[model samples]
Target: MGSIEQPEPTVKIPIIDVSGYLAGDPKATAACAAELREACENQGFLQVIGHSVSEATQKKFLDAISRFFALPTEEKEKLSQSNSPCYRGYEKIGGQKLDELDTNATTDQKEGFSIRPERPLGKFLAGPNQWPEESVVPGFKEAYMEYFWAVHSLSKAMFQLMALSLGLDRTYFDAFAADPDGICLCRAHHYPPTPPDAAGRTRGVGAHTDFGALTLLLQDTVGGLEVLHKRTGTWHSVLPVEGAYVCNIGDLMQRWTNNRYRSTMHRVISPLSHTDRYSCAFFNDGALDMMIEALPGCVPEGEKPAYEPLKVEKHIVERYVQSYGAGGTYIEQRA
Candidate 1:
């Protein structure tokens, strides 16, 4: 019986094919919506297949990411993350604040580039990215911009699912849409080879929850992301499947559901002795002025309030600055 590996304490984390719903078929849309409810309550994470983000667009992002990260340290360092009003840029290894989460614990060992949707110079999360000039990286600006638009569209679909899962009409959130600009951002990561963790250490990104709404993850080759099943206290490897985007709920979902949903802790752990990893996350941010209050249908009665009503933009930016060591100055422009 002990050989069962303790069941790994996993939450099923449903797999849904979105092609039907996206094709304007009512039957498929209903089926997809039902599955999203199951996933949100059980794991708050799932594998999205049949999503229309073509493999070609995925290849473009992958190719551009490979080329961008392959640049020399001198060239990449020019766009280091410290230059942004919101700290979005190239971040060196072990950079980034996970906030009050084990600050003295070992820092994650990796480097990445952060890109966000376009907005006025003063907007915190929607500002332009610090792309490598074409001269330096050939077609980086062109590629990254194209990649951004593609993921942005997918993020919108995920948002609609969130609204429906909360027992609200699919268009409920449309009223709170960000100014002509939302705060969706993307991060392209590169993790170099690392030795195995001793007994209790983690690699890549640390054990923490995402601070926004849904996260659409794209990975290439190697894998290291792990999700901690709160019910079982066991960690499970987040397996990779080709042609699918891995989706996970964030703190926003947890709050909206009054804690019925899980925004569980996830971290990156090293593989064997030698391996490299590449990953990207399209962070789905709600509108700047949206009120992040609990959903009536989620908690019912006799359930304790899990989170206070918060302005999503404020909570997200506040957490981002704190997690990395900044003194809470990422002032997001209100819509």
Candidate 2:
């Protein structure tokens, strides 16, 4: 009897300043919700910084997303994503396989544009947004809706500091994000520059695990972004931090925190820098019929509520029909 080794995961990626919970300051918002509840229960990723959303408005929304990915691939395939319907638009370069929900994953070379919620909710991946010709990217729709409403108001102040780090009531996710209807989305990625004989089976995004409930990313400093230290299975590097805003915790906020927060498993490792790697995620995922459950102060008495309720838009359209299938009908087929 002799074979045991697990023990490495410790790269320490927490930067959470949150400017005293955006200056409401109740003792710096309880020390920023105890450092965002120990960085969302250890490495579900974090790195927010005062979050005032200005580095010249995230460099004018990454310079209008590098002028809409330097147009002309037939004018960005005339806003592709197979002419939307709810897939939003533009996706070109290796047009997403995002490891098509993993089958030994590997297809993501990256190139995106997605967008949702331009108010008119009605549900099911909301709708409307495929813009590109504000006279051909001159202020690309007002610098991407002013950095998407300033990171959707810092993801509703990070869901009230993730409900005051779970002791609840920091407006406990404000009635599941009631607003002009929430189910936020807003991608922008680009990636490009990874072709030296395709760099070992490509990947500017692959690992996966972020089906919603907070994402916020912003990147652009040409990093690569990795993270998956599940107890030393190794893969860390999430470096870039100028005006920080990496934040993570997804999988519907780790099933409403019953597993006590953690949705890790990130990736995007192609950039060794030939100069090309913008980013802009957003996500959020609330109120698509919001039900989620599990948060009775994150169940503990007799321990038994790991996750079941779930309904946020049918678990985000059944993880987008198990990661992009159903061609383009993310739920609405019932016959």
Candidate 3:
């Protein structure tokens, strides 16, 4: 007799609500903090609800970016990132290889536009952004800039919760996140549908760890995000949840927690069907020059930290060099 087939195991990424905590309820804050600790230790990825970014704002942001990407190829290439000293502009598909280890294999198959709100020249990556001419796309800059601040506000609150999760005071990360010049980097990525033949051979983005403190991602319904399960050792799809932002820790956070929290490896694969995928990632890296090391609260009673201490800028720039090569070089001379 043939054996009965086993049922597929259910896989779910944890989702947390912060509305109550955001409202200043001490009990809710503690509960959210504990949940954050568990999620960080195990999955390293979660969806956040009650983040206070309204649906209208989210729609406007997406619409503005979608309009920009829909422009003619020549028009978009006018702002090619390769020409930017600050590395802030359009990047054509296959411009980056996120999985630096697989040199012989395919590079990432997505196009992107990166922006950092204009600010004083302070650090390597800090300066004005490369935006499309106002005449080309009316109100584009304003819409994107508005969304940047909205998402950034949410990131700050999440940092406080992350601090509390590690059994530290809520203000633990405030100093690192206090600088406006080093505030954040936002990227809008567009992944064209995967060709039928390239389905198994190419990835929209290669597997890699984020080289920052925190990342908040807003994705369209054409989900292609996947996370590697720590225990199962298999990749699972992170489906889109309406009105939610996918949140995850980054390398600096992992170092700060002495490996107590994870900086999980993740990647994106394009839809094999005709659907395109769009996502905007808001990365809050903390003050660029801030030193990153294991917090005393995170180190075990006698064990040494797993990673060596380093400055936030050093770690981030090294990762960029790996992915963008010479194109990632920081431009010192301002135009």
Candidate 4:
């Protein structure tokens, strides 16, 4: 007789309140770390509340992004990503194809702008960002940078929790992440309402796994994000909760943990509502030259590491080349 198939368990993404950790309470921090371990191992995703990023600040940054996206196509095109060697600046709707492995994949129906830490002109992915004139989008740069630092701080805190979860010293990951060469890409995405006829065909962003260490996402209430359940082969919607940032482990983290933590596949479906959707994703990867290898605590006795050590930046550059095709020339040249 054939073996029976058991149904997959219904999994809800965990919501963790990080206020105590932010306040430096040891017990609360450890408790949250335990919860985070379970969430990362089982679903690779969770929502973080009480992360200390102000609501007013979030609103200001999002408002500025909305205004920037509302500019004339010509003006927006002036900062096109194609013009940037290091992959910073504006990307128009239908400019990116996220699901490179899917033959039927279409260009994503979202517009976006990307920025990274400003550094000397010779550094790859570390040069100055292309911005709209102050007259074009008042307060855009200021608001965005403020939010960037807030999120960066939160990411560092999260790393501490992750270390505790893995039975390592709380600062185990800090050295790799502390360098100026650490690559943190901040992206603002705008998904316009899909027409009825196009709703069935297009995606705001195609199904893909993030390629970095961690992703912290702030999404507006127009919910369309979906995550794939590996065990069930089913898709689940991720509805946005007010004032919470959705957080997820990414490929690099999973590699570092020897797959003890997951990096699940996720995507953004086109919104059915007439209202637009806005989201900001901050991807925190460790330093460019940092070697990603399975942590000792994550490997069981007599088990081998699942992956070879990889240079963080090289891995990211390769993924970008696959995803962006011709637009990935800068990294390709470097390779």
**Residue by residue across 1-335, what tens digits does model 2's lDDT show?**
11112223337688888887798979988888888898888778888888878889889888888888988789988888667666677876654454533565545667888786675535576767788878888988788888888888888888898888888888878766546677678889988886665434247777778888788898877777878776666877777888698988888888888878978888776744467888888887777777887877678788789777878877777777655552222334221
Off by over 4 Å in 1: 1-12, 99-104, 176-179, 195-202, 301-305, 326-335
Superior by lDDT: candidate 1 or candidate 3: 3
Stretch of 10 with least lDDT, candidate 2: 1-10
| Model 2 CA RMSD to the hidden true structure, in angstroms | 19.7
- Expressed as tens digits, the lDDT of each residue in 1-335 for candidate 3 is 11112212436889999999899999999999999999999989999999878898899988888889989989999998767666788998878878633455467888899998687555677767888999998888998988988998898899999889988889888887656757488999998886787524347787778989899999999887888778876777888998799999998888888888889888886656677778999999987779998997788787888989999878777778777753233434322
TM-score of each: 0.88, 0.32, 0.92, 0.93
Query: After best superposition, candidate 2 residue 269: deviation in angstroms?
Result: 32
Clashing pairs in 4: none
TM-score of candidate 3 versus the correct structure, residues matched by position = 0.92
**TM-score comparison, 3 vs 4, better candidate:** 4
Candidate number with greatest lDDT: 4
Question: Which is the winner by lDDT between candidate 1 and candidate 2?
Answer: 2
Steric collisions counted per model: 3, 0, 0, 0
What is the TM-score (0 to 1) of candidate 1? 0.88
What residue pairs clash in candidate 3, if any at all?
A: none
Q: Model 2 clash pairs? A: none
Provide the lowest-lDDT 10-residue window in model 1: 1-10
Sort by TM-score, top down from the best: 4, 3, 1, 2
Worst 10-residue lDDT window, candidate 4: 1-10
lDDT, candidate 1, 189-296, per-residue tens: 888876566443345676689988778999875767777776677878777778688899888878877887778787776655466678888887767768888777
lDDT of 2: 0.76
203 in model 2: Cα distance from truth in Å?
Answer: 30
